[model samples]
Target: MNQERSTLPSIWSAAPPGGIDRSAFTGKKPNKIIPVPHEYRRQTLSRERDMLIHDVEQKTGCDLVPHWDQGKVTSFDIYGSGHGVEKATVYLNHWISNAHTKSIGASAWAKLPAYDPNKWYYAQVEELDNVYKQRFRGPVPSEGDADAPRHAAVVDWPEDIKNTSQEFVSPREVFGNKLERLDELRMQDKVYITLQQSNHDGHWYLEILGHDVVDVELAREHLTTMIQTVRADAAGVQDAHNTILDEREGMEVELQQCEPWWPNQADYVVPQLLSHAMMDKPGSFRQEGLHFKQHLSLQRSIKAALDDVRRRKGAYDFVVRLGCLALSSKTVSKGIIGRTVSKDSFSKQIHESVQLDVKKWLANNEIGCRILHRLMAVKGFLEPTKSGGYFGYTPETLKETRPIFRGTWVFKDPNSSVVATQTSYRHPGRPAPFQKPVEDAQAAPMSLFVIQIDWTDDEQGMYEKGTPTFYKLPPGATGPKKNMDISLLELGESRAWHFALESLIPVPRKTVSPVLVGFAERVRMKRNYDISSTESFAEWDTTLNIKKYLQTGRLDSIYSFGIEKTCYKVELTAMWYPSQQLPVWGLAVRHLEWASHLAELEDLPIGRQAMWLDTISSFLPDDGQSSSNIDEDSDDCGTRRLKVDDSDDESPRDGIRILTDKLMKLSEIVSSVTDCGGVQI
Candidate 1:
């Protein structure tokens, strides 16, 4: 009842923001009984999928199978003014002809006479090797002998192979008839609550959008029957229409007749008129009469569809709400009521309703649906197509989009005792120079910046919340704010370790190993500063959950925290190069490897290989230990056990420190590699 008042005739012209307004044309008494034209225009064309298929088989020597229902295809009509009928018929006919030609070969297509631009034609073919076979229109090589088997006779097209011309031709066309008939039946049984329009012609047409649910299981039957009635009733006609203005008086008189004692009388009558008008208009829908009629229609349909499971305390309602908000103009954020619903509730509804159903809406609107699917993936809501580039948010990652921000690190060259250094990490790859190093390499005094966003997608997926900007400040400084006195390390040239920390080389320089003592001096000059950042903790949590869910499809798996504990384990990773200096190369490599390898694994598949490697690598001899291996029980106690290699006077005690230094270097390499998201490529 409240819904009826909201959609009263007076509000028919109301339009939402960013949409066309037509409310001005509503509510006032009609000057005459003439029907009001539907807002959208409709053009009709001869509809016959089966006839087309038949023609195709006769002309082309091959067979084709239709994936759509023939009856539904025939539901389309050829109607319009100013060549609308001719234009529509020709258009559909040519498409059919083209399908036939393409299915056969260029040779067969060329043999068919040029199609008349103003007439309709039909063709059909059978499925051969699961591909629709049609006539070829291009040249075919002639056989040397007159009796040689004809080249144009028949050919096979494999289902798995790629064929550009036939890519748009789906096997589903065979079901078009059945679906169309179902739609017709649905429309007939439905008591429409709003305006519906035929194609672009302003004529009345009927289609079953949905049905009322007096009973759940029976509703589907009722809906299907309504759809069939609408289609069958209009099958033979090319010119037809329904207008809202035509029924206004009858509704008003009916309301007046039941006046004084009736409760919610307007509700019953208004819905009846709206339904009548909807039936009158075939290919049209109410965009103005009701602010969100289509949304309401689908919502109601969903309610009915889930009737069997509706009684269960499921996440359906939450998903519906979240999807509606996401697709709306609402801004999403923490504390925002609709922003952070659990992924289970948020992702499911969008995946099923918005992603799947809305696709059909576009098709009915004469728009394609493929691009929309891609857009969903871009926003991180739905699983991306196989060819898409974005990773992180897949099921393997707890089905969460990882949020990352741009960040930079500065540190002095360990070889340069005089200066501290800083570094930056970026997307295309890690900050260069550090990724590749030689023996005499010097730490590049540069900044590293990385940007990342979470994988959760909003409704319609228009915005992506990537990483935020991060800054590191010097000690005594509150943050990366103005007036903070800080000295930045001066990078002489760039240098980084190659492979693991096996070697170091200077950026842009071929040889000459830089001194470690100088690099150590650079480190001394630097001091820790304040670090400020906005991390995507939600996304992190989501990714962790997604990883678990991927391992186990159960929704309950999301709350499990197995991965979080292991994420921060203190373990050694193999360095890309042998350089004892902590270079980003080793870290970057390790991260890339992890992303590539783990991205494919579910939480359960996360093997122990990495764990084992970390353990074994931690046991390698420290640098100073190798120099004093002859002694086992002496370390100057533990004080001289430092790992730095000194002169002969240095005792085996120093070996501990040496070993510690080597181990630290190794650990740093492993940590760095795994820390990076993955190689951009």
Candidate 2:
């Protein structure tokens, strides 16, 4: 009952001086959280897992071990589209379809096919060995021999490999299904409530969007059937999207930081090397990450699906209030969040660079003609009967679509420094280079200016509606003031990271690399800043707590601390190459923002004050951690009690940072989860 039912006024505005009117209550009504039982939740996840797997296999024609390739091949590698590389080979002694028979000369041999577009046709290479070598010594048969003793005609496909897990269920297709359900949820309701979404759909379903739910139980008996059906019933799908966020820099969620210190050193040597290190790490996240904004927008849009009921809660603000404000007191354990790995981020970046080109090369290039034909076989378009390969859409459903927004970008040189040196473009008197036009000598030679928004993301993503303008051109695009003068190191290219860091990176960036920003710098905020930022001390304290929770996977990990006892280093390397930087800074900010929001709700009146109880009577730590307390009659249509945990360990997690050089501060600081066990991959 203490949960605030009244709507929080919209914080964004399209007009000047006075941004969106904050005084008027204009957002959607909040949802009521009705807690369900654990068994019910588990069963529902189980059932959905089974059904979805069957559905995907049926639609794709991958039902049996024989339907695919007559069992000739066991496992094959799939490259591109996030699939890494693997090797392959073909057995020539297999069944021949021709009727003629001819003997092969001693020099005759079989040639293996080369790489195909977007697909790895085989798994290994026997590379036709020296003609008579024992391993290559098979009864030599003619190409036209229809009855050559074939390699085992009934070869079995290994269902155990990662690529073949689709025989169990398709991850790509499941992601498609999750998106579809999200689309449905977005349309049905006018005003979406994080509390309601979490309770009804389960945190696994909402974790990608960053919502950590706290349940208020209604009744025990009603929960019996509710648990088995509610979660699966409302979500329409399970959130099994394990596609790793390809933006790892300093995103390991580790409890350490690394960088050279001392301000005197910032100006002297080649700063680009330091920037290169940052680039090798995670760069600005929220803005440029793959689909960061899409997940966020999906959550926000869930309220009305962009229909009649309007919501002014940009992704960041709502999470701050929801995680930081609404669910401040509790931890969400049933939640299914994502995993963030440095390798995934690094690989993603690497693949994206050439994945497209590789696909084209394998398709249009003359060398690619045969390779392209091989792809259609497994793709279900296997018609050696036709000339132009045509593997049409499987189980053709409605084409998936989401909202889009107009946006701009500036940074291009991955070598630019995140640290402010005497010669840096952002150093005091120097004009902000990112703010300049591409033609300006000060600007990045390959600077990007326009792009679209992925409205379904949730990594603190933001987007503007009007035609985007450039470098500090005043009378802001949607409001009276310009969007810059933000004190953090330039996102250089990622507005997504800036918005995400509006709540996450600084403390952690400073935590590892101390010399980046000054102590005094962290303390100041301009009166008219577009993004609502917290003081360094608040951010610092919150970040430290977040670090502990991530490592321990415990809700009790969050405890208040004194700013004086803490040490901070302003990480100025946010401008480092995004790949290297994302795992470090990007992930730190992401975790911090997510946990801080939930911790926000734990404390009332102010974030600084927090109360922790030793044990929760009602929850009872069923899985391993401590649980919540509940009273009798608590289930009398009153509210059920629920706590959301961090996302299950297998989910994908990524990060980004936008720290700038600044001096400052007294501060304190420090940060997988499983979704459902036996969850079909």
Candidate 3:
């Protein structure tokens, strides 16, 4: 049949015997089967096997290709015994591949009768050539690379390569079983290590070879969670610190604009008085002077806020330090491994970077804490003393009059009225004139005095006259002494009395004329007596006494008694009386004296002016009338009084009060920033 077909057409020949041009007559060109290079094929197959091994290791958490004593055994012969004959043939079975099956089928098809299963070897290979084309044939994974080593097992198989049981074995199941065996070996402490003795006689060198895969993964997860938590806490602290900074800046600007009066040596006394008043009746003082009390309350609140901020800052610092310690521990653990381990350098770099970040965070917290402390200190300096009614009058003091003095006098007869007098000259070895007979008397009798006492604050008896009385003198005294004791006590009450003494002085007598005995002798005697006389005539003017008493009281020499005459002594005491009327003229004169002392400033500063007006207003009868309508004119006392008109809301007093209130509100806002719920870590 072949001879007959060749003779007819020779269709299979490259060219037909006849010149028919069969190449052109063919319908399509036959595809060429290009031969793959051996090196390329090997590399491509190696990558495919590595990818498969990596997939199984990820699922099983085990090393499919384990390290051996001779070197990294990349083949299935884990013992590296070239014969490959072992009772435990499980690993050899797992190394079987399609290449072994193809080679066995080719030999079986060849009909070789003496084919040995032990001679058949396993080689890692893929059935589809497309798998080699799809994979990237890059450099093979190295021992230290994070990727799985690109290795494939080549083993001398002891079993038939065509066994269907080998095909049913899953790579993941085999690796999982191997991992369990590794765990068993680890638990039994069968994993061995190499120890080298150094050249020094007493020295021994040790090296850490590897770590448990499970333990390392667990540690990594734990550290990752801690890192995420630290990052969150850091973000929260940053936000809070920034908010505090902004509030503090705003408060600082407001504080700069406010020029509240600062306390001086003279002004410090008012704070002491106010503190005492507050201590005496804290609740009442706070209730009555709510506006004024805001200054102290805000100060305390700010201090407490500052303390809270400090505590939170400390906690934040501790957390930062703890994070730093954790990072350092991680770095130290990494350093325990060989320097050739790339993660050591990476971990050390991360630790250093975190340390710098921690330092910056702590520095920012410190600066914010310092600013809060400064704000607290500034708040401490704003005391409500100088401009708040001379220590800020309470409701009780505002309504009632404060008595300057009180006295009780015993009389021999109820109808008799006696006047105490001081003699001009006193006899030697006798009691001095004007001296009280009763040593235990409440107050000494005044020789010449003028007093202005509160009469009645009610509208019907607002101008009631003050009664002028005198203490009875001893029988032996005689002189031009004026008994002056003024009382605003109710009528028909004589034993006990309340009064405010305005002035007191001893009266002096005029010089007596010398009589002439003979014409020449009388002239000589008159001239000699006039030359020797040291006493001078002095008039008793209550106005001058009141002025001298207001300015310097007993401190002035003009109101002082001479050494030969005894002076009247008075003991004054302060008492609260709901019915007692305020001495308006006396207060006015005292205010005038206070103003005169500040004459160098020309006019009181706005702060002092407010204080002065507030003090004067407190004494008023709460009728809303200004000082001008108070009727403080005292023609008898002859002292200048303050007559301030109610300048309405334009007054400095009201303006200062408003400004102070605004400042206190601002302080409250500034302190609110420190109210963090608690420390965050």
CA RMSD of each candidate after superposition: 36.4, 34.9, 52.9
Model 2 gets an lDDT of: 0.20
Q: Rate the local accuracy (lDDT) of all candidates.
A: 0.22, 0.20, 0.22
Give TM-scores for every candidate, taking all chains together and pairing residue i with residue i: 0.13, 0.15, 0.12
Report the CA-based lDDT of candidate 1 relative to the real structure. Answer: 0.22
TM-score winner between candidates 1 and 2: 2
**Number of colliding residue pairs in model 2:** 112
Residue 279, candidate 1: alpha-carbon lDDT: 36
> Which residue pairs in model 3 clash with each other?
none
TM-score (C-alpha, index-matched) for candidate 2: 0.15
Candidate 2: tens digits of C-alpha lDDT, residues 38-61: 111211122222332233233332
Question: Which of candidates 2 and 3 reaches a greater TM-score?
Answer: 2
Which model is ahead, 1 or 3, in terms of TM-score? 1
**Candidate 3 lDDT tens digits, 369-469:** 33233333334232211111222121221112211221111121111113222132445785643222322223223222212122211222122222322
Off by over 4 Å in 2: 1-515, 519-639, 643-681
